[model samples]
Target: MNPSEDQIYVIIFSTLFLGGLMSTFVVAMVFIHRQRQAQNKQKLDQIKSEHEKTLLNIENEIQQDTLTHVGRELHDNIGQLLSLAKLYLGSSKPEKQQEGKETINQVISEVRALSKNLNLDWVESLTIEEFIEQQLQKIESTGFCKTTFEHSIELGELPKDQKLVLIRVIQEILNNAMKHASPEEIKVKIWKDGATRTIQIKDNGKGFDTSIESSGSGMYNLKKRMETIGGDVSITSSIGNGTLIHLLLPN
Candidate 1:
């Protein structure tokens, strides 16, 4: 069964054609898989964005509710006490009257400062830095400590949700300093480097064991929240030294 040379050539050509066709189909399949992967990533990003927006709305509602509760306490409780003091001062003996009046004035000043922060409208309109300053000012007004804040111009351009989350984190840190640090002063610095914005909070109070404190839910939550936004949190501390919190945001 010997075949001619023409038949052999035809067989070789047919084999090459089929090989080329298979290669093309494999390439097409790879291209389709990449397209599907990209589509899935886009959908996931959209879902994440919607979730963050919902969280921000909840934060706003909580702030408003807190404002109302504080307003009521200031008016119903401290306001009435101050009025009573004023009335008592009016009836006191001459020398005692002067002392009472001076005491009342001091209380009034502190109360007025606190009242300024109770306004929901004012709180709503503030930028992140302004809100931080407000909280710091309240702590400093107690006459126990001083707080300083510095920031780059780029910080003001952050998205509202980003700013909101940062403010809460800073608040938590500030509260920790005020309650536990025994710090004479707290310093806050904010700046931008390329696509990243950073905030550094330093205190002069006695630092603590980082390993022991890392187990706290507050700090863990802080790290988690930052991670959700593609950011990071780092803390450094040593006993008798101070604590430093470095926050990095991908802006």
Candidate 2:
């Protein structure tokens, strides 16, 4: 009743081969699962980036619409009112001339200020470097913050949109430094890489965490603006240390 030697050897060989095959199958399944998970993660990241870009574009469109409406209102409604006031002043009774003159002067002054806000002639006519220098001059006149600007790239030929966006970014940075950072000095630099433009804004101030709860809407808006314009923004800071904002844009 004992099995033959040849039969026993055949049984052992069959068992070993099956065992190896099963182990190979298990390993293959694990590798396949890991590959699928990695693919899913990559897809998720792409979707998130696309979503952020869409949201930024929408916000920029809304901002542009609002600015256009406000500009038109100032030029048409407020400007016409001021013109009417001036016309009335010329024909007012002699006894009331003084009062009318004062009223007309006040109206004219308000109109002029409104006009400046509505008209971005500075952006259209001046290069980014010149415009930044002019802004620095205004800040310097305040005597509140010592400002310095340096440039390694000639930004004179940048597109108007890019120049305007950079200008606004710089303005927001300076405003934040003055109002919140409480820094006595601020520095701005612009340079270029092979096909990229770089801007660095730095301030010695009480820095905050870069977490969601720590930053305000201003920083969020700035990041959104940069993304909308195909640029990237990065902020680095810590408590008691200075804040540095780096912006990069394709040239």
lDDT to native, each model: 0.77, 0.75
lDDT of 2 by residue, 29-94 (tens): 999999999999999898678656655554465367447866786688766766666666677477
TM-score of 2: 0.55
**TM-scores of the candidates in the order shown:** 0.65, 0.55
**CA RMSD of each candidate after superposition:** 5.9, 7.6
Clashing residue pairs for model 2: none
In model 2, the worst 10-residue window by lDDT is 54-63
Segments in model 1 whose C-alpha atoms lie over 4 Å from true places:
1-72, 75-124, 152-154, 212-215
